[model samples]
Target: MIAAAWLFGVGGAILVGIGGFFRLARPALLPEDLRYLRRTPDEIDAAVPSLRGWLRLVFIVLGGYAVATGTLTIYLAATDIRNAESSAVAVLAVTGASSIGVMALVNFALHSTFRWPLSAAAALWIVATLMAVVS
Candidate 1:
């Protein structure tokens, strides 16, 4: 069960980290045809300039940190299978659920960043994994 939690969280973190790196690498990959949140390449280029050199490096660094932390947490969870059914799991579940809600908010309000929705769903998966671990 704890292994499942770690899998979900770590997988999500890796995917998100990759997504962030992709944004930094090729911001052009972002969707530009959504009606609700119509974004264009021009807008992206204007907003982020695609290649910001040092800024890109910074984003990559931060994203790497997030990935590392998430992976470590997952590892810890896996090692805690004996006592997985604890309050910590419950807290993670709640956090994951809220993260989903926050992702929804970001999607609707920001209307950009395709990764937000994926992250939201991933959060739910992590929460579900936590529940399984607790059980």
Candidate 2:
């Protein structure tokens, strides 16, 4: 159980960290499907020049938050697993699952190209959460 938790937690953290880094430091390096630069023609026409600046800031802030959240998940799971605290483990499991689930839902609703990857991650998290609960 501990091993599984660690695997899931660390994997999630790494994936999120990479995404955040790219979004913040080299957005152009991100894959076209994953990039936030895909604005519709109407959206582009309606957007002010300053909107790009605001969007960049928003992406940076949101990316940082995502990275922090992923890091917290890893830390919480590791600490709780190390302490052999089932209750703490359960809490982290539920929290991690819900967080990822929300992200998946948001991506789906937005019709984001990243939706499939987010959905897969969310599914894995949910399974890990369930296993933690039952184990």
lDDT per residue for candidate 2 within 1-135, as digits (tens), equals 776577568646855774577466744222443345576544554765565567677677777767777777777677776666787667766666566677678777667776897788777776766666667
Candidates in order, TM-scores: namely 0.52, 0.73
Kindly list the per-residue Cα lDDT of model 1 for residues 60-97, writing each as its tens digit.
77666545545644554555533665655655555444
Q: Candidate 1: where is the Cα deviation over 4 Å?
A: 2-51, 94-104, 113-120, 126-130
For candidate 2, the TM-score is 0.73
Question: Highest TM-score, which number?
Answer: 2
How close to the true structure is residue 49 of candidate 2, measured as C-alpha lDDT? 52
Range of the 10 consecutive residues with the lowest summed lDDT in candidate 1 = 26-35
lDDT of predicted model 1:
0.54
Best by lDDT: 2
Residue pairs with backbone overlap in model 2: none
